[model samples]
Target: PARRPPPSARRLMAEAGVAAAAIPPSGPGGQIRKEDVVRALEARPPAPAPATAPAPVAPAPQALRAVPEGDRERVVPMTPLRKTVARRLVEAQHTAAILTTFNEVDMTRVLALREQHGERFLARHGVKLGFMSFFVKASVEALRAFPAVNGEIRGESVVYRDRYDIGVAVGGGKGLVVPVVRDADARSFAEIEEAIAGLAKKAKDNRITMEDLAGGTFTISNGGIYGSLLSTPILNPPQSGILGLHKIERRPVVEDGDRIVVRPMMYLALSYDHRLVDGREAVSFLVRVKECIEDPERMLLEV
Candidate 1:
């Protein structure tokens, strides 16, 4: 004789739209308990329609189907850091009027400069001279030019920060983490690269601390390494602006508005809080960054 689930468990399964036959019993003497019914509800796939239902109600060819028991989908809980990131991202979207502006930078000079001095720079600094340092320096210069982009809205007052602490987004073992490069305006290019490297190591090792991510006047996210051609990045909360760097690809461009030549170019995206930074300021800020990158000497000359 097969043991039946208790009346309460059966009622709960019915109320939850779960079939009694689908639930496995785990109670004493093979009786189905309420917990067993709840587990079945959580693990259940969408119910199929009755055989007598209309033929037109059939699921589409692309609709999901249940797999074998061994190939069932696994449900894993989100970590605390992941949960926090989710909440903050939603909050940023809701609380700020966000806008993203795009621009493209010709990487001719920067790439040439890197090709020439990259080996020497790495030998001296013990770290590779990556595009991020250039972008960081460029961002510092841009922020200095457009103070409004570095400013945030606090209550009814616009809080403009004098210090430039740039946040570099890095992929961590748990998820993405943004670590700050403190006093970026004062740091040398090599120093900025070193700070990013160290922070990235800490993040990969899952040793990144709250203090490491405490505050930032601005953020930079480079999706170039992952082969993204272009993407509009979302704003990180409390900060007025974020710069997104994408993959550099060879594209034909007119030189002096006549000669077409192929050159390596990268698209840049500046996502800012429209509530604080106007469209003109946002566009100009991105343009300033492009100017610095296209003419790498401008960053060195501090022009």
Candidate 2:
């Protein structure tokens, strides 16, 4: 399930070194959103005047008069879905030893591959080839390479999931929701795209059921669609890891033989429950994803 706040907002709070719970959420259903973060920063109280400073002159009589109350106050109760998101996030913070690591991937190859094969693929599957399938397949490969990232802690034991059930975060009318793609590891790229398309439709239409939202081993949240440049994702309860995708921008970088060129780059963040997955495992998992996305053929070849 998606957290009460978008993962990007939570990441912003962490990056600013602020307490997550202390900030007030102005988002729908009292969830902290990106705008709320900006508001909090802008509204922060300035440092108090020094004790030695003179107690300045009093305000004019007209300025001293109490200002009439304006129509600025409003309250909305939390929806059940939002309440569930809040409770689970707090529980995750208290229970899991959460940590996040980041990396950047060059999307040059993936973009080229899509452009070359997209037309044929669309004609055959009746769906346009998109980036989600590449990432889903890449994630499945990465999860296979590092099972700990897919595993969850149960009581005193770590449960390793044999099958890949990935939750793709989508925005719905109510709030953000995650619908699972069952057995993702076994699905082809076209299949993955179609599944995501169908699920996203159901989500936007508010027709997704509880069964669609349940039982996921891992999750992928793409804040890039909403223009987030980078973010550290929060873990969904019981799951050990979640991946965050950010906006792709063209940036210059040095390649082999001291050659510099501009390439489409996207930042990736992996947040894992350190209680179950180690730093090495988390880092390696992210690297594996980067490799697969950088060379889409690796997924097709099962390399």
Candidate 3:
């Protein structure tokens, strides 16, 4: 009589790298039960033990082989998200036209203005006055002067925006997010601060909505927060230009009439799409913004 395998046979087979077949029992509609299979396998398992073999004698220890110094070591596997990020970053390098330009500015005037007005500005408006407001205001004015710097290539046609929608490059608690301040041109300094502060807070909390992140004509990245003295900021995709703000340090700069004084100086960068914006226009536009920030009255006057 052919016997059935034990219930534990599947477990033993799985461990030994062998397949286990389920055997049906003697009933009309046959079924394998645990009690029958277990009894059969347990009772039949008296196979002869290998006739007591002699223990092998121990050999002497062998010396270890030396490894060459030039062997390249460890390799780690990349996750799916990491692979995708790497591919997209590489793809941008091949297709996009990238260029970086740098300039230094005396932030003495801008900082002074902020210091003089910050407390009162915050007290009245419920938001602190930050450097971004000055840059946003100045950039909007500069874009008006040089519209091409704020333009993008669309199907062989250049599209320029009449109004400004500035993307504020904000820091989350960890990563970075660019939240757009729509119609930045029409807003006042206080309004800009309020909007930027709200977006920045929301971004940190990961509560920034899609509406807060879309539609921007230009971008401003403030690397100064991380103490970066100078850096060429990348253009935020569709936007043609990005202004980088750097840390301010006290440097002896020549003021009016060659008066060398230790003033708060900062490095600024305007990286724009050269294909859409000419060198003269890009540099000139940055210079105009610098001029506006340097002379606060210039912001009030249409210059």
Task: Go through the candidates in order and give each one's C-alpha lDDT.
Answer: 0.88, 0.87, 0.76
lDDT of 2: 0.87
Q: How far does residue 50 in candidate 2 sit from its true spot (Å)?
A: 46
Best by lDDT: 1
Candidate 1 residues lying further than 4 Å off, grouped into runs, are 1-70
Top candidate when judged by TM-score against the true structure: 1
Scored against the true structure, residue 6 in model 1 reaches a CA lDDT of 75
lDDT of 2 by residue, 1-303 (tens): 224888767776776676657677766777877556645654565445578967797666874766568737676666546755776688789989999999999999999999999999999999999999999999999999999999988878889999999999999877898899999988988899999999999989978776688789999999999999999888998799999999999999999979999999999999999888999999999999999999889788888
lDDT of 3: 0.76
lDDT of 1: 0.88
Instruction: Give lDDT tens digits, candidate 3, residues 1-303.
Output: 345444444553443343334433532334434323333443343455588878996664567555568878886555322343354346445545767777777787888888898899989999998889889999999999999878887768989888799999888753577889989988999999999999999989978654576568899999999999889887776678889999899988886888988888888899888888888988898888888888866886766
All candidates: CA RMSD in angstroms?
13.7, 12.5, 19.4
TM-scores of the models, in the order given: 0.78, 0.77, 0.70
lDDT of 1 by residue, 69-152 (tens): 787578676665675577679879999998899999999998998899999999999999999999999999999999999898
Which 10 residues in a row give candidate 3 its minimum summed lDDT? 34-43
TM-score of 2: 0.77
**In candidate 2, how many Å is residue 5 off?**
30
